[model samples]
Target: MSANAEDKLVIMNEEELKRKQREKLKKLQATGGNPRPARTLFLFNLKNPFRKACTSIVEWKTFKIIILLTIFANCIALAVFLPMPEEDSNNTNINLESLEYIFLIIFTLECFLKIVAYGLVFHEGAYLRNCWNILDFVIVFMGLFTFALDTINKIAGVPPPAPAVAARVTSQPDPAVRRKRRPIPLIPSVREADSEV
Candidate 1:
């Protein structure tokens, strides 16, 4: 209404705005200044510990394929190995061992990528809370434990028997691996044979 009253109102508004900004700045500073933004699954970046590329073979899609394949292969191996009624208790299958090694290599690459992605910022609590991240770590750790056990057993002059090879043959191919396999040639002989049958 009056010019003086208008001027006072504008000043009050500006002061309130400034106060709010100051409070926001103070809260930010108290939290160690500019908190890092939360990571999204699809739009992973260098700051995300779960997505750093550790090896030429360890890209995002490659890692995903590896994880899926590992699950499938492990399930198949377990099924094949578990049902066997081997006469000898000491006879163990080697298929499981090879699968385990493959899993270990993938996991090692994963963990290495994670370390590179996070660099020096990796926190144990954060690492534990992430699902895929934690699973990768666990897989690698279990492989390492198995390796240690095998090595110790060897050193004690009592090497464990190799697992049966059947598991390896029966294990399902990783989708990626299956795709890489050469497609069978469609020979006329095969076609004729099929037609006859």
Candidate 2:
């Protein structure tokens, strides 16, 4: 756009805007304003349930650390569950699955904290606006999916095989089972049996 058109669009001329701001700052300083107030700890108040928490750089760092720890918890649970053998995974896997649920719960809570902290819409950078926040939200949903699958497995008494694995392959009975319940033959030689024992 031409400078003439842009100039027309501006509601306040730059000089006038600057002058107004200076006057406002002067008034604030007259009332003992420090221009920049010292940062304070964010005390959560239960009365104002929707109020955002610590907005300063330092408090944001603390929130980031909490997020990182939750990620680490997710990684640990995944490490425990993913490589486990199917035979052993059924019974023992429940424990790791429970651990994942704990992480999932924490992630859900973090999402809530972010919502209450930043708000759902624009203020500066909104919670859902940033890509990292979106990623975090996605991870939380994926964790929920895993928890649901685990719950279903617990209810069914068996985990479903992967789609790539045919049902028939895993459905086959154990190889050790024999049709005949053959009687054990007595040892032919007592001395050899004693030596083997």
CA lDDT scores, all candidates in order: 0.62, 0.63
Q: Which ten residues in a row have the lowest lDDT in candidate 1?
A: 34-43
Candidate 1 overall lDDT versus native = 0.62
Candidates in order, TM-scores: namely 0.43, 0.48
Residue-level lDDT of model 2, residues 4-107, one tens digit each, is: 78787674577789899999798657535633222212433323434423234214776779778878877776776754443445755787766766777877
- CA lDDT, candidate 1, residue 14: 100
lDDT of 1 by residue, 33-135 (tens): 6332233233554344444334233446866787778778877877766444433332346666566677677667667655544432343324445787767
Query: How close to the true structure is residue 166 of candidate 2, measured as C-alpha lDDT?
Result: 52
In candidate 1, which residue ranges exceed 4 Å CA deviation? 1-59, 83-92, 119-126, 159-197
Q: Tell me, what's the RMSD of every candidate? A: 18.7, 12.5
